[model samples]
Target: MIALVRHGETDWNAAHLMQGSSDIPLNDTGRQQARDAGDKLAAERDAGEHAWSAVVSSSAIRARETGELIAEKLGVPFIRVYPQWFEQHFGDAEGVPVEEAMRRWPNRDPEGFENDEQARLRALGALEQVAKDFDGRDVIVVAHGTIIRSALMSLTGRELGFLGNATASRLSQGAEGWTVHTFGGETLEDELGEPAAEIVAEVEPA
Candidate 1:
């Protein structure tokens, strides 16, 4: 089992800005949110949820801090950062408001913006790598919202929207393949849905 968690909020997140690949730090509220999320995860584990062996995170400072806080609560090791888990690169739209960017690029395909397919593939590859590194053990992966969303879509073939700050989505791997248990707190049925490849253009920030 793998628990995919979004990093806590940053100023850019609060402003509805595109923070792809940006190295923004979390605010005080964001820090508290991380701790609260950790507490919740601990409670879930105590209630017989899957036990995690380690906490891994993206290279971004915000993600690293979130993972560290969760590790402290779970009494697990905080593994090194993985650049492969970095958020999708937004190109010229990185710091712009999501609405403004959508207006400028109706299809959300801005110049130099990383395409959804690439992000999805990158996310899948990262998941495989992480699973390999911690073979036979469940782990927590703290990453940005966009990449996490991409992974969920690719794994479950469902149309998922934005993931909330510090929220977790769970996945389990079996002999057949990866199975999505929940997405952004919504429990999913075991049946797989049709693949929804297109990322919603008018959607809000990742």
Candidate 2:
């Protein structure tokens, strides 16, 4: 199983900014969210070692910080910079409203990503490399929403929407390769544990 957590909230995320590959620090609420999630994960591991064999995160400042904090809580080690987990490039839509930008140019990444197909291919290849690095181990991935979403599509045979901010997506060992327990969003733990179809809720910067 993989505990796929997204980085905490950023000012850009709060403002609905579309920051593809643009680094941003977490706002106060984002910090709190990470702390809360970390606490929950810690409580789960109170009995013994965490289920994760290893933890890895995007090298982005926000994601790295989140991964480090969560690892600290889970009693895991190693917080390295991994570029394969970076967010998707939005091209001309770098700092605009994410939804608005998507509406302006909703792309159908049938055989490739939204921008620079070659770069997208490189990113996919790198992701496979990182996954291979964690071969035969359950892992934790702290990354951006785009990366998390993309990974879900790759891991499972399903392509759902982007995750709600700071939410965790879970993939468990299943009859088939892997299965998505939940996408990123509030109420995700319950959703995963119970396997229900509820609307994904957003928890804003508090």
Candidate 3:
């Protein structure tokens, strides 16, 4: 099982700014949120509900910080950082207000911006890599909301909207492939069955 956690909120998130690859640190509230999330995970583990084997995070500062806090709380000794898990690069739209960014580049075609398909592919690849690396172990992955949402949408064909800061979404891998379940353990989707190649073919630049 892999639990995908969004990093805690930053000031730019509060301001509704585009923070794609911006390297913003968390605010005080964000730090508290990370600690609170850690506490919750610890409680779940203490109750023998789940045992987290490791905590892996994006190389971004905010995500790293969150993963560190969570790992500490869970008494997990190792934390790995993967650059492939970095948030989607918004290019010229980054660091601007969200509404203004949309108005300026409605199609996201301005130089430096990553298209949706590219972001989705990166997210998928990162998740698949992690699953392979930590086979048969439960892990926590700290990443950005957009990347998590993109991966979920591609796998489930459901637009889950923005994932809340420090919140987790659960995914599991088995012989049939990846299966996504709600945090409550309800089955949301299954039978993904190695769609990476299919996604690559479908989203190829045309």
Candidate 4:
């Protein structure tokens, strides 16, 4: 199982700014959110939800801080960062407000911005690396919302909206391939534990 956790909030996030690749630090509320997320994971672990072997994060400061807080709470090791898991590049619109960017770039794709395909490839690559390095152990991945959403979209073929700060989306490896079990607080399974929808794509480890 790989738990993809969106990093906690930042001032930019509150202001609806496009903070791609900006290296913004988390705010006080963000820190508290990270701790709360850790507590939530711990409680779930106590109930035998899953055993997390390690915690990893993106290279961004917010993600690193979130991973560290969660690691501290879970008593798990904080592993090295993965640059591939960084948020989608917003290009020249990095510091602009999302609405204004959308207006400026009517198609909502700014110059030099990473497209969906590229983001998906990066996300898949990161997951493949983590799976191989962990040797089938469960891991927690602290990353930005955009990249995580791309991964979820690639696997589920559904555009899951923005993931909340410090929230977790779980992906489990199965015979067919990776299956999204939890996403944005919604379960992708029926009461009998069967997947509600078939996975649209299977990612082969590189």
Across residues 94-197, which tens digit of lDDT does each residue of candidate 3 receive?
88899998898888876798889889989988988898798788899999999988887777665555578998888777776667775222234322322322
Cα lDDT of model 2 by residue, 1-206, tens digit? 56778888889988988777778888888887887777776675675645665668887888888887777777788446678778776667777786787777677232223554444454455555555677656677788877676555554434456576556776554333455566763343353454444332221111
List per-prediction Cα lDDT, in the order shown: 0.84, 0.66, 0.81, 0.87
| TM-scores vs. true structure, each candidate | 0.90, 0.74, 0.87, 0.92
Candidate 4: clashing pairs of residues: none
Steric clashes per prediction: 0, 0, 0, 0
The TM-score leader among the candidates is 4
RMSD over all Cα atoms, model 3: 5.4
The residue-level lDDT of candidate 2 at 57 comes to 81
Please give the ranking of all candidate structures by TM-score, highest first, separated by commas.
4, 1, 3, 2
| lDDT minimum window of 10 residues, candidate 2 | 197-206
Best by lDDT: 4
Candidates ranked by lDDT: 4, 1, 3, 2
- State the TM-score for model 3: 0.87
